[model samples]
Target: MPGKPPLLFDEAFLRKLERLSLVARRARSGYFRGERRSTRRGQSVEFADYRNYVRGDDLRALDWNIYARLERPFIKLFEEEVDQTVHILFDASASMDWPPHPAEHHKWNYARRLAAALGYIALANHDRLTVAALSGDAFTPWGPERRRRSIHRLLAFLSDLPAAGQTRLVPALTRYAGQTKRPGLLFLLSDLLTPEDLRPGLSTLQYRGHEIALLHLLSPDEVTPSLAGDLQLQDVETAARQDITINATVKTLYRQKFDAWQGEIEGFCRQRGIHYTLLTTDRPFETLVLHFLRQRGFVR
Candidate 1:
């Protein structure tokens, strides 16, 4: 029998999470009442501004004190608090299941933990949360659920997700961007090992008005391989093989190419107002969530 999956969060960690909430840079209209302040004025207790009273304005909103002092009726506008929709697009492509060995700091496992932590924060704050797994042509999604009660369901979905198939990022992202009518904060967790150009998909999401944060996951071996001598590397997704001789010069070239690739992605994200963070599997997921994310203004 398969051993039980490790718990994603402990009770103490969950208690700490309850104090934090996902931050949205721009106000968004939400379906249900929540902690986020909306752009629209409503009946919430927080005072927004005062506007000249119009003919059809609600009599209850009239500031009687202002009317008495200035002899002009002003309507009090209160800020509306509403829930935000949070989307976590997790890449469960074959590249994420790197380093093969179970004891290693698996990229897939690390991504899942990050997703779970973010989902928990959203749920705790009563924001609608959706967790989607993207692999090949399939985009499996789970919930637009709100409240702490849904955390278990979110964890379960992520725990059962398997990393397989090629990374079809563009298609998956385009489809998701087209289908989601309401835009909010979107977090993408992926290894991003695909050869496809990601600009089109990212642009589509941005055009649809979603605030995107890309968490680029990588393993230590991928960043700095220790293999030496001539060997054949088989692509896990396509089963394609490549012959290469690992030498000091080759290692230097590989590092340069890798750095250039990462710099390109970061530059693209910077130009498009998308938040990009490179995460290594060896780093503690808790530190990424509680410290790095907070420092980056993602959570508070």
Candidate 2:
């Protein structure tokens, strides 16, 4: 890991991301006050709507202009700017760590940077953030923190994390959902190359009230393989081995299946209102956070 680049965004980059924030699709009601606007009435400067004043209501929120005109007290309900929780679930399974090739360092490394950028944005804007690495059954969680001061902790946790073992996506997600006390925006970053179907996991998160975003990552080599004939392939997770011959026909067929699988994942997420994006390890991480994610309305 000596030649590996640093794990964090630079100060200038951090400053830029500080101005951006994750978008809350709906008015979220959270326990603490934050930068995100909510449907519930609160003491924020932006006003939302008004309703008839009831007993025990605060006198400060009562609109004197409406009362003088109609003789009925109307309470002003301003849009409440409250904290929105952002959970980044990163996949640290063995398959994510491809080796013996240049792309071996790419997938998990890119994911870490992506998580760091978003986590910085969340913290800078005072949104609660929890980053959990999905290694197996019970994963490791770093935080449910909101302050920018915790950025160091986030970076450290992500940097030192190791990728290993087989991760059944469905089970990992189910466990994560069960432990999540509050849900806002959940980003699941993974290759999703596991044997388990991703549908059940996605559905579980959706049912638990988490706004899901799937960031599907694949190495460039994995996408467009240039391997020759007589290859011994081994599964990174299961250690299953198979000997096969790679011909022109094999490459063509593999490409077709790969494209189809990507399409299928996209369609599944779309039907369920989950945000999905396919990214290659070679793509600039900055482009993903600054352009691709913005285009999807993930960050603004």
lDDT of each: 0.75, 0.75
Q: What is the lDDT of residue 66 in candidate 1?
A: 98
Per-residue error (Å), model 1, residue 72: 40
> Candidate 1 regions off by >4 Å?
1-4, 7-36, 39-80
Distance from true position, residue 180, model 1, in Å?
0.9
Q: What is the overall TM-score of model 2 with all chains considered together?
A: 0.77
lDDT of 1 by residue, 1-300 (tens): 112236545576556455444232111123122225554544346564555565665698799999999999977655343246889998988888776855337787778878887887667555668889997856899987875688888877887888888868999999998888778889999888999998898999999988898998999878998999999999999989999999999999999999999999999999998989888888866566766665665543
Q: How many Å off is the CA of 190 in candidate 1?
A: 0.8
Write down the worst ten-residue block by lDDT for model 2. Answer: 24-33
- Tens digits of lDDT, candidate 2, 50-82: 555656666987999999999999777553432
